[model samples]
Target: MSPTRHGWITTPLTAGLIRGALDLERTERGLLPHRLPARARAQCADPQLHMAESQPSGVRLVFRSRATAVELDTLATKRVYVGAPPRPDGVYDLLVDGRPAGRACVTGGATLTIDMATGTVEHRPGPVATVRFTGLPAEAKDVEIWLPHNETTELVALRTDAPVEPVPDQGRTVWLHHGSSISHGSDAASPTTTWPALAASLGGVELINLGLGGSALLDPFTARALRDTPADLISVKLGINLVNTDLMRLRAFGPAVHGFLDTVREGHPGTPLLVVSPILCPIHEDTPGPSAPDLGALSAGRLRFRAAGDPAERAYGKLTLGVIREELARIVRERAAEDPHLYHLDGRDLYGEADFAELPLPDDLHPDAAAHRRIGERFAALAFAPGGPFANGSG
Candidate 1:
């Protein structure tokens, strides 16, 4: 039964073969990965968070094998807007012994279409598809298949020409990161190219990305999850999602930030923790958000975003990017005296005005693919370089 099809050996998907997900779900079709555990998921029934947490931003399948070919069967759920252009197919990247080896995209899967204006959704089911990678060296090697960061996927099946085994621990430093859609690889080309993934590669560390799209709103459970997860280094990128969602005012945000950090500290008080502020977002910098899709652009078959909140709302303590950054810096500064390991990194250093001019965010919010690469490289240089906050053994 194991070698039923040709000489391909079908290996059952298991937790040890995967990385970067907190939970594995036994779905009707296959194994679905969830960033948040079921306990945390039950606390909030928000559909957006449900979708984001299942997108597998930093999730990958890692194993040791001597196979020359591998094939994976997956069932993916892709999102579509009623009026906008069709989203590109999600990319699956193959890495052989820690290097880019091959890439392919799944063809058929379910589609969920949403009408932004009407708040309507239509679900159209599709078929399961296989993503195959061949032409590998016929020698023992570590194999990794990075899943798509922008689509929901279920691991249906795994097959290889040779038997596979769990990869031995490499003793690499573990780096955990949290943020909004940008960190979730919203506009990134592939999984490994996501800024956090790229940064992890450059820093030579293992990555645990908790970058939930539009859902990084300083949830207590998320922080608790971060608190409990094991890692040698940790960084939480805050501000973008909060501003865009208009989740709270300054009065509440300050306490929420503190509470989030407090929960994480409860678990790893000595871990080299980094608190990063919002990056340069022009629309939300001086103005408050509730960002909304640009209806005019939508009519023209383009997807764009615009700030919906009034700038004058700042008088009411409504949070803006500029306000949040200042507050984050001050909070870190005040807390650092008592907690020596706490640190803050201005998000602007990752993407500033000059970088914006050169590579503007295509949707007036999320960075484009090129910007993702630039941000990733810059983060690696600043955070992992000598004398940096995440520099060698700072933890």
Candidate 2:
């Protein structure tokens, strides 16, 4: 929990607070800045690269793309490390669609801390603060989040959102989405252009994206996280991550899903929850799926392989979306008798034959920007529009 300007103790941050702070400071009135090279001073030529508040409460800067891209979502276990420190008295602003979404403040101030030798700016009296922007435009496409004070303050560690984004208003709805790398927006053009973002735009609902890149294995923590977060509409896109990770066998898969949903039900109770299985992938379609990697690609420093060994050496390794869908549908139907809101939607509904042919994924793993829009548009039409196909049945 970052400190408030008024010295109030808020557990988590509200978006409104974030906006107010950036505006108070009038940080975003100028052009974007660029980040300098590792050998040069922290300040650079590009507008986005320089530290500036896009809004009074939100700050942003173009991070040194050449250095390292910061990881956004992660479990509580890992620690974040920054190459250089931020300038003293600097404030970081978060921007949504080139506007403010949030900001971070450097505290325990110590200036003149640039490391000429290592090109790392280490500030004294650590503990930087963050404030997030709320009442955001539902149509927001991308979020421009910046860490201010690059010359003196280094963001070495971070904590996850404590309580998570809140539930929608009394009359409004919440959208909960889960998926793998595509859902996590790996190769997507920009943050706002993700399919989930597009869908949220069309649906006019709050979003909680639980899409982890290579980590969605029906883990118990993820289930608990979903179960605990508040929501009005929920959807989980399963299968691909499971297939790619090769985490469990068919025998264990069914029980794991049932248990995961059971956890979600604890908090949502009767809220609508949709389970979406994988979309079509030719590599794993007809043949037995590979739990291990194609080592030929890995040795080149390109593709990553999680599991070990070649296909011939493995005895138990196939887990298909077709298999999971059947099992998941059964679970939903079984539970629907007791919980009417339980539902299942096949992933093909988002991207089937026609759409796939029109906007094919680049690497055959994730969808492109055009596909993202298509998926989001299709999702909105099918799931959110009143009396649509996947809506609450009037019958």
Cα error, residue 228 of model 2, in Å, equals 1.0
Task: Give lDDT tens digits, candidate 1, residues 14-101.
Answer: 9989999999999887899999988899999998999999999999999999999999999999999977888999999999999999
Worst 10 residues of 2 by lDDT: 72-81
C-alpha RMSD of each candidate structure in angstroms: 1.2, 13.9
TM-score of each: 0.98, 0.57
Model 1 spans > 4 angstroms off: none
Q: Which ten residues in a row have the lowest lDDT in candidate 1?
A: 386-395
Cα deviation of 391, candidate 2, in Å = 4.4
lDDT of 2 by residue, 1-395 (tens): 45333442223223322211211112122122211112221222432122221211112222111111122211111111232222234344545544444544434432334333243554344333433344444331444444331222222322222212232234545676767766755444444556776676667765556565655678665676677666677788888877775667777888889898888888888778888777765554433444444345444433333333244423454566566667777887887888877777777888876777887655556676788777778778877779653365211
TM-score of 1: 0.98
